[model samples]
Target: MSEGRHEDESQTRPSGISTDVEVGAAHAIQPPRLENGEKRTDTEADGQNDQVELGSSGRNTTQEKPYSVFSTNEKRIIILAGSLAGFFSPLTSSIYFPALGTIAKALHVSNSDVNLTVTTYLILQGLAPMVIAGFADNMGRRPAYMLCFTIYICANLGLGLQNSYAALLGLRCLQSAGSSGTIALANGLVGDTITSEQRGAYIAFASLGGLLGPTLSPIIGGLISQNLEWHWLFWFLLIFSGVFTVPLFLFLPETCRKIVGDGSIPPPPLNTSLTDVIRHKRRAKRGLVFDAAEQAELRKNYRFRFPNPLATLWILFDPASLVILVATGLNLACFYAISTGASAAFRDEYGFNDIQIGLVFIPIGVGGILAAFTTGKLVDWNYQRHAQRLGITVVKGVRQDLTDFPIETARIQVALPILLANGVFVIAYGWTVGHKISLAGPIIFLFFLGYCSIASYQVMNVLMTDLWPGQAAAATAANNFIRCELGAAASAAIGPMSKAFGQGWAYTFWALIYMAFAPALLIISRRGIQMRSAKKAREDKRSARRKEKMNRKG
Candidate 1:
């Protein structure tokens, strides 16, 4: 998806809420529009003027609303929905692990073959996000979420009954497809609803599910599998997912800019809506009314472009973003490595049963809970303190005069405890595990490891959203894609990697990698102000040029 193309277009009033399709452009990208009832160009307006202007492109360019106007109720709904949605995918992923053995035995497949099912699901989960955001960005949050839940339901049903290995593999992939959308949409919705100051806290809460789901899944799965048939796992997920979807359908208002006006930009103006316009044109051209949802042609446009699975590669390549990505990836990799390796390691070293294995995961869960609840308050305090130190207003008020706000201070501030805790605990955990130390040694380290990992994950998550507010979903999807890919690779290779290098030595290497993220954090902490100011300057200039172009077009 080009940064210049608006995600949506509607034809009705001359002005509604026109969102800049520009993701991180130095110029104002025009929203996709209709010209004489046909699709027009996607180029953005050039940045050469000093006032707000409309472009030949149909989008209305205007100032952005201050983030403070989001009502308490609105904020709660968005956060809760996002978090719940985000939680489902991870919940399903781990919940199925304990059942894998049973599934293999029932399907009459080799364990290794069954393991491929897990690997395939993981791959699909990582890949689904790159494309789903484009749909949510264009269609509306409600529809995208509906589709995700629909997929989730259907797959869970199949998963419960499937007897063949091929059938299981197919259904699992579909399940992952549904799971992918939850976190992807959650990040984007939070971006829509919260301010930079409060965003960390919001993300921290939403991320609870991602951390908790995995931590608790094995335990929950083990309990269910031990007492009942393994199929009950899917049955339970089906019921819970269905219940969650009902309220979500009823209360989850569209948070996409195209659906709800943010009070700054005017909506697109045309005589026909995006759907009607596209449908009519297609009928005129092909002598048939094309179905937008199943229209093979239209859907192709929404598919993930290959060769760049990480949609944020450009963003990641930027020296600043690269640093962030590496640090965040390290944070993710370390935790996943520990968690992934834990089950096998525990069974071999401590002779733990499935139930006992689940119990051992409690330290990680508790640590995550503490960090998640605590980080919210800490983030708010940090934001307020920064505001006071900088002599900026410390109240919930609009910034009516500025083209953009400084977001880097908030971004870098998160790195403080995130990098520190993550690095220290990882090394400690590794050292203890490597030495085959006492259970308390490993358990104590798990506590701190969970704390630092979740804390860092929350911080890195919010920072990514802050860096590119409009593209939060895609940005997060990109984060998910990258970190998950790295984590998956680590999972696939760690057994050999650890074996080649002693467990202690292997972890020591991982610890070194975790610590390496510190320099990146330091750079961002030190130079974040300059980078943010530069970004703001460019945005201001683009907004000015957009204003100039609009005047000329009018």
Candidate 2:
């Protein structure tokens, strides 16, 4: 049956009709229409069609394959690898917390000088992704991953051996530049392989490493710093990242849709994995070959382009994107204030040792873990509920036309309540810790704060992917840019702010600031569709103009 369908697809491809039509022939499904009522162009629909012809095989029959050509297990493995890569970014930051005082003393510098390293690490964290994300979106995820890991591994080595404050500050920025793009790339991987309907859950799962890093790192950092010296932290990061990088390079297949197109087309030799290379040899022996013409067709108009940091800034300036980013960035600023201040506050107020301070972070981490499990499923359920309410049929493994769908409402409805709850916890955490309440009192609030913060992050992460689609990495880079800048400021200011204002009022200020941004969510929910429509119309006009010029040249 598959062979017969393949033959039919081949015959139909020679004619002017799109391969999407052939794939949909079984179900009599029409091509999706744009907001303006025009059918999707052949180029737009080709991705779907390629999945049917090229992805249909022993395990992934054309009828059964999801929007991504990769199987369920394959997707899980890829996301896991991406998540591990993301893990190192936050781990690098948080692991240094327990050693901050030690490092300052060893280097004979003020504590504020050590804190400056943290601040600079974050600033680079925001800016570096802009440089890498455009490359990831245009080139491929694997190569970008390779580039980041290589830079990260080298920076860690330098950081481990460095003795001076100057060396520490410079290497930390280098480390930040190396590690930060992993989160953006991980988010991009989700966009590459998952559809919007199923994206909420997958995004949460992919984010587990990042969300858990802050939760878990302090404990590990405390253990290492308490037993050994501050330098071992970087040594640990170097070894750990090296272990993950080697396997990822060998096993993880490229998932960039532009480069591989739903995992159907073969990636360039550089992007191909060792496992994929082995599999390709076996397939060739079985008389399955990707002929020259097919390969050329896939490569047409796709060329290597220079990475543009400005592309990230461009997305930042978009009306809808700006609102979403600012709101999310404000939330991140609040989170940073809490996490960054916790070590100092706990040490000073509660008179906790490094190990005890590290242990106190457990509740927050626990909360983030719980949020990852619960919020993801909740968001998915919300998506389905909204689809049902709109009378839109959502087919598994098929991309839905979101042209008229209330996606903003579906995502934000789940987030708004979570954000409000988060604000409450932020205030509670501040007051409990400020009054020198029982350790348990603040610990409990920390958990809820962590839960609410990460849950809100998951929702926005998924929403950003939905909003930008193919440019998920760039969108996330912009998100990182805004939030990290705010976070850097918050990290630097939180100490002074806490010193000036009491802890209770300090967090209350952050809570109020967070709440101020809540209206941005409501605004986007109400007006996002109109903004998207306007943006799409403008994009379509530009596309039309380019095509007309190309035709005249021809």
Candidate 3:
């Protein structure tokens, strides 16, 4: 699904709207045209261009829009802001693990009751992002971002101060709702600004904060929870949100294509920074203002769209999209299941204490960070290699018509060998722990597991963004939803599986079953371009039927 495309409906026009298909692109990669029943207009004739560039992605390339490449500094800042935003969810989720027992003791709740909040958190973490992302996709990025952070701040404050089990349950749900939007919004911002050619590095940077958070949070939480009271965890979140997230979000200008209509259109006043607002106030005091056309342009562009959860979930119906979602989710689940079982296994098998078990987890985090950076570079490199080998002229700012490139081969193919190696580590790690081998064995395998799993997972993520360029938020929300569900399920089952079958057999089940993804990878890598073409065709046919019915009714 190499759909490096844009939603031209969101592009600004002189009439404040644009037509769907390019007027005269006979071979252009575009939505299927209405059947040619009427004579063509001379205006349409005049619009034809002789530029016939080839792209194997099966879409016509003639009608694609050219975009401005942001300067290095601007790119860095956008990724930085997005990465900071990405950090909050995992931080909020992981930092609480060390404090759960303390929290239960302070609130005088049963262990089971305390564990229920974790489940509640995971469930909301899966679902809330769907609703929040709808707004990010439809309305604007900045407002949605502000909304999520505000909810997060409030939830953290309440959790820190509250002393009831019921309050504990509710606040964690609220916290999950708020924090979960960061990854979706971060992906949206990156998609909004960067072209697919150069997006890999930026996606790595945007995701780095998420990887860093979970890795550091437990160690930090353990230290804080052991020394201070558990309430300080939320206090730390509150201060961090206030000091870091709020100021950065306030200064971050809106970047959604639906709202701003690409770089050519000026951003709305509200989307601008506090400095811009002050400058505007000063200008107004001096009686300076926009002319008639400018004012009318603002009026035309201003719109409010309510969130639609269904729309976010609908992408799963696409076969290629669904397969990618499930595979990535399960791969993520592998990590979650293993990590959740790690501490108990360490304690029982090696006689290690809580702090030692937590310390051993650091290598997994390091592996994740290393995987993101290294995989990002490899993804970009692979994309270019595929492009050149296929003879597509690689353009930096221009979205390449991926019609010709086998993107699955480019993104995921390179990672397959790595994944096979990862499976071996998965089996070995399980056996190592089960056999109570040297401590170094499990650590080494866990590190490799993190590296290989993340590398493959990152490829899937990049491919997803490319497949649904204009709907990055919804697509990401869907991805996150699947991963969380799988994570929860896998986390729950790991203990049972281990208890029932023993660690060696339990993880051997995982290793053998992982081969199931091979068929999906083959299907997607081979069939993605055809699936995309067929889906577009079906969409066009349905649209034509609807329009014909409307005409007859009229």
Q: What is the lDDT of residue 349 in candidate 1?
A: 74
Candidate 2: RMSD to truth: 7.0
lDDT of 2 by residue, 1-554 (tens): 22112222221111111111111111112233211221222222223443222222345423333355466666777887798889989999888887777787899998778888989999999999998998886678888999999999999999899999999999999999999999899987877777666676576569778877988899989888888888899999999998888989998888776666656467898889986677567556765454455455546635677877866877877877787788888888888888788878998898877788788888878988888888888988887776657545454545434565667888899998888888888889899999999888999999898888889988987787777765678888989998899899888888887889989998898789888788778888987777667766776676689789999999
Rank by lDDT (best first): 2, 3, 1
Q: In candidate 3, where is summed lDDT lowest over 10 consecutive residues?
A: 14-23
TM-score between model 1 and native: 0.74
Question: How well does candidate 1 score on lDDT at residue 395?
Answer: 20
Q: Which of candidates 2 and 3 is the stronger one according to lDDT?
A: 2
In model 1, the runs with Cα more than 4 Å from the true position are 1-70, 99-118, 164-166, 201-204, 263-314, 395-406, 532-554
528 in model 2: Cα distance from truth in Å? 2.0
Worst 10 residues of 2 by lDDT: 14-23
C-alpha lDDT of all candidate models, in order: 0.62, 0.75, 0.68
Instruction: Tell me the RMSD of model 3 versus the true structure.
Output: 7.6
**What would you estimate as the lDDT of candidate 3?**
0.68
Against the hidden reference, what TM-scores do the models get? 0.74, 0.87, 0.83
Residue 422 lDDT, candidate 1, scale 0-100: 71
Collision pairs in model 2: none
